[model samples]
Target chain A: MKKIKLKVPATVANLVCGFDILGMAVHDPYDEMEFRLLETPEIIIKHIDAFGLPEEPSGNVAGIVLLKIQEYFNLKNGFEVIIRKHIKPGSGLGSSAASAAGAAFGANVLLGNKLSKEEMIYFAMFGEELASGVRHADNIAPCIYGGITLVKSTHPIDIVSLNSPDLFVTAVHPQVEVKTSDARQILKKNITLKSAVEQWGNIAGLVAGIQKNDFPLIGRSLNDVIIEPIRSILIPKFDEIKAKSLQLGALGGGISGSGPSIFMLSEQKETAEKIAEMMKSVYTEIEIESFVYVSKINPSGIQIVEEV
Target chain B: MKKIKLKVPATVANLVCGFDILGMAVHDPYDEMEFRLLETPEIIIKHIDAFGLPEEPSGNVAGIVLLKIQEYFNLKNGFEVIIRKHIKPGSGLGSSAASAAGAAFGANVLLGNKLSKEEMIYFAMFGEELASGVRHADNIAPCIYGGITLVKSTHPIDIVSLNSPDLFVTAVHPQVEVKTSDARQILKKNITLKSAVEQWGNIAGLVAGIQKNDFPLIGRSLNDVIIEPIRSILIPKFDEIKAKSLQLGALGGGISGSGPSIFMLSEQKETAEKIAEMMKSVYTEIEIESFVYVSKINPSGIQIVEEV
Candidate 1:
């Protein structure tokens, strides 16, 4: 196959209690990218969208991952990439992760699938780091592995795929930008042992709840004691949206990544869509244009739209 | 049943990474207790062991739980309690929890089994509070729920029973007193956010590992970044014992609760017994009297030997 077209997914990281570990992939608002293998050792990128993302291979999120692929494989031939991103960059919904993981995944497919899922996640982290200045797999792992993925350790890149219950997600990306680097800068260097204990307990409960398919338990454990209290303030009307959504029967949710985006989980698709409408109304009432998505979690990530 | 004879199993709390949240019950060295209901509202206690634990209703661990039972139920009658504790006090095994949980279990049976398992755990906290200054259900919850348990939140009493795989436990209780309160006091009130994140990641891994009954995953998740480094210093030969145990094909384990007692987990019963023998030899060489136990994970927490 000389050309491969991919539908790379958007993801939600942190999942409330799992600050640097948990994430999930969503079905809507993905990026469309096509990779064409070149006979010569050269690279090129073109953006069909007006997002004004960097086309330079080193400056681009997807381009960085592609560069790593070339060097890691010591390939004499490179690839030309075309990008059209529907998931807005800087929306706090894993836009950069989609690009990064898509680059690695697409290249691997063109290279005859030499990379494992973990290897895809590893190469994807460099792209994630380009976007956030931190090498984190919270988003990349889930994007590559699908379902819910827990990043146990990043140094050697250890990740576990968790069981996904029958659940729906409501995501709202308000037209606001909260830079990931800035979001990370605001947190304190240290947290009280008491808060840490509470956070771990909630994380454990959330993992177990998802494993057992217990909705109430999942709802109860979706608490962010450490990160959300500080990061939520940067997003407009964060508290109102979260609290009212809970009242509207959202299992629970918070700042999707670093946040101009907020996502909530629910048991019913009707409730999830209802929450999405409510989220849209809140942004509309506030005179802010927002993109809303109601999706059951993507079980298989990065679909092959066309391969030739 | 007007009279009940109980065998309350011992427990190991913390389970490495889940400090203050995780625990497991073991089948060996259970305490034998008998409760006899009387016509009048008064509590009596007797000890057949030479441990010389306080016999006063409020001063004793089991007695305190009975005191709460009498008051909570507003009973017209109390009970006579005889105790024989084989799990030594301050051994870092859940000796106090065994006694406390046994009292609540036996009392509930004698009172026509009115209390729920959670209620038994809640009432048992008073007895635990007498042993240490804090009321922790890390041990009590497991002793009541059986198998591996996660105490998500102590307040409002949330306890989750986790699936236990076919794993063996090897325990060594060196004769030294590491008071629970003192061990707790030595820990810093705060931890770095990096360490906290590491801890929660491992905790979530451990929970997921146990739920899936994946043994290697359980072994890797048995790390304790926050508590073990500080608490292990209080136990003799702590580092060597843990290191050698891992080398001997043990999965992983750490200080069972506060210290003086160390536990390791393994896949095979023969490996568990081998680890137990090695532990005994270490203490023997050090000239410290130690008690060793090799057993399977307890499924039924407190057993009813007799009821009349």
Candidate 2:
């Protein structure tokens, strides 16, 4: 194929009680990219839709993933990749994962899909490594596979998408910057064994609940005992947003990934919309710009929007 | 019903990564009890088996459970309970759970089966409190529910049975005793946050694996990072037996509850028997008395062997 265009959806990672192991794909606010083959073996990238991201291959998230793929495969042909970024950076909405997964997915399409899904994720994680100074697949796996995904192990990188019912999600990203490193640094190196047991029970229940499609079980199991107590301190007005979300019929709500963004799950679209309103109220009180996305769980991770 | 004879199977609690939360019931080595309604308002318990167990109503596990039921229901009538104990105490094979659950279950039957399964487990947990000095329901829940069970919380005692495939079990209980209190005391009060994360991932995977009937996934997820490392030291040749069992095609195995009894899961009955052989070989080398049980996952927790 001479050219290909793909759309990669935004993902929520570090799920409640799942921390660095579980994630899910959301339908709205995706990053779009187009790739065209060039004669010389040089990666050329341009930001078609801008959020002041670096245009160079080394500094850019998508370009770094594409460059890694090129180096691994030793491709003689180069590609000019066009980026249309929609997901905001540092919002804990998997902005870097979208861009990185888009590049790897697009490059694979150009190569006639020779790489396996696992291989694609391996290549895409480099983008996360470059962006966050950490190599993690929690976000990228869901972005590539769609739906709720589990990264059972990171060393060999085993990932599987968990089938789930049609559930609505409400995500709110307040106009604030919360560094991922700062969010991670505040967590305790050691946790009480009592808390660990409680945390494991909730995680197991959550996984089983999603598979069994038991919504009430999911609601009861959506709790984080290990990471949330410390990380919630970094987010502004975290308690107010979470309390209001739960009070307004949202099944459960917590800090999405690191900070500045909060998310809730609901059974109905109307309830999700109402939860979104509750999310916006927090930022509105402070007169800060906020973005709310109300959507269903996206089953298609990265799609080929247009292909040649 | 005037009289009922019930058989309650032995259970394995903690289940490696599940630590005070997960348990499973086995088919063999059950405690047999016969309950007969009496006109007098005094509980009578007779030890029919030759284990020299207490025959007193308040001191015996089954009698204590039956007396509690009598008090809870305000029953003027009493029961003459005959206990034939086959599972030995301090074996990590849930001997007390069997007796306690059998009493509650038999009493519920006499009352025209008015109590739900959850209520039966609740009443039976007091029996565990009397035996182990801790009010844990892990063993009792599985003994009554008849499958792999998860005790999500113990405050109100929330429990659920996870659906599993037809997997065979091979359990070996050495004559040595490991006190429950000692086993519990050796565990670290706090665990590293990294180990806790890894432990939660395995627990979630194990729950999903059992629900999905994925044998390989179940094998991969049957690990205990927190409890086994410390508790296994109390069991003689624990490492050798586990290694031998795995090498002989057993899916996985670990310290059954606390120590002295080790269990292995296999995909076939023949493999389970082979694992049992491996377990017996450990004790055989030392010329110690050991009991080996090869059976499948019991779907019937407590059964009415003879009823009138």
Candidate 3:
């Protein structure tokens, strides 16, 4: 059977100070999925890897995404998806989002690109809700739109794609799981107005810096005043990693989405690679197995590898 | 002695959802100041209008600003400034910032533009500290920059000038007083994390909208969920003005700086003029004394109105 092959890139959500609003896509650790159209109206799911994720359409992230796409488009044909997982499911690096966004995008493209990026994001959010307790577009928006995205409002689904500068990203995914719900449960329900103001200032500065292409401004604005102070306790060597990354000339970074993983932004590929080496050295010293990737910000979100 | 003629435009701080961070300049209601260089180091201050402002070198907003500038530059020459006031103090129209920024900028020009915008903003903040019990740069930055500005951090004085779009502004200054200190005192010191997230989303969206030049996106992101709800109560007819202005094709608007004055943005000059007329008619019917002005976004900030 002829199949559609897809490469869906991973993403870093809650970019530094922009909690729940800003996200960016990365080039490495893409999930390669293969899919084929069925003559009969029966959706089939298969896994080509040992990730041991669910194959049931209702329970699987990619499965539920395709089901919704099928229902929305009202297609008589069904999809047979063969998955290969690379991004860990709970690495705080948008694993489930890749699967969900990949499924919706692949289906839409196969159906002659019927839906807009906004529509695809909307449908993919269901799968995200199933993975995490809340329906957030921070990760999904970047995964679908590519580059950096601002989720202005999810209720009305307003997503803005910002201009991506020529910057490199270095990410480390330690083999520790931090369920998004658990990570969210630890946060305080209220913050002091002073802290809130500081956070808003940083986020505003970060957005303006990106638009103006001010590298130093971007670095200065990446400090998180609220979320990181609390969430960093969950990851081992979090403080050391961040301090070392900055000392190694990283612009700034923080917990990618919810938490076991960390990401840093850099102006050059060499700096990004150096940060990766630092991450590996620290993790090795701590006797923890981790995966590190140095790549540029992904300008294109999901790609079609080939149709076989 | 040849005099320096300058026009410093009024600014709208807390531009909708961006309280304490984002600000923009308007062309109308500017304070015109005349400065002449003195032979010895003796700063003389004068106000030509019936604004009942203090003229003492230490107690005056313009006086304190000039003193600091003279001290910083160690200039042997003093400035004799005669100010003509139009923007009213306690009108939520950045009146104090106009004077402060005007003094610093005028002195810098007299000193051959010796200081950068950052240094000028720093000197102007002392005057802001005297007017309101806190040091803030939101108003001073835009007054000096002549466009939209983002005060990223005030401690180190980081300000960024955003690209100003071709938008018209209509301002209504109702003759009532809302002190900056009082306006600040009424706000809650703590805000819900949920509301803060919403606010950050809106601010990020607003900055992106300005950079992308998306009019409708700008309109959509102008909703303020925090400060306006508390401070708007201090302004009479605040809710009505906002509703009617939006109905009149204004993107959105709120209390300009704190209270008593409201500003709305429109795409067309005729719409801005119409908003001005509506404001006048509404204030007239309410038996409230008012002043209205329709102008465009002052992209040049403070102008040298013929440096003699």
Q: Pick the candidate with the highest DockQ.
A: 1
Q: Which residue pairs show collisions in model 2?
A: none
Candidate lDDT scores, in order, read 0.92, 0.87, 0.89
lDDT agreement of model 2 with the native: 0.87
User: All models, DockQ values?
Assistant: 0.90, 0.82, 0.89
Which CAPRI quality tier does the interface of model 3 achieve? high
Candidate 3 residue runs with Cα over 4 Å from true position: none
lDDT (tens digit, per residue) of candidate 1 on B1-308: 68889989999999999999999999987899999999988899999999999999999999999999999888899889999999989888899999999999999988888999999999999999999978889999889989999999988899988987778999999998898888999999999999999999899999999999988899999998999999999999999899889989999999999988999999998889888989999989999999999899898789999988
Candidate number of the best lDDT: 1
Q: Label model 1 with its docking quality class.
A: high
lDDT of 3 by residue, B117-234 (tens): 9999999999998888678998999999988999988878888889897899999999888888888899999999999999999999899889888888888889899999999998
Q: Pick the winner on lDDT between candidates 1 and 3.
A: 1
Off by over 4 Å in 1: none
User: After superposition, which runs of candidate 2 have C-alpha atoms over 4 Å from their true positions?
Assistant: none
Cα displacement (Å) at residue B220, model 1:
1.1
* C-alpha lDDT (0 to 100) for residue B226 of candidate 1: 97
TM-score of each: 0.98, 0.98, 0.98
Model 3 lDDT tens row, A1-308: 35689999999999989999999999898898888888777778887777889999989998998899888878899998888988888888898999889888888877777899989999999989888867888989998999999999888889999978679999998887777877888999999999998899899889988888888889999999899998889899999999999999999999999889999999988899999999999999999999999899998888898976
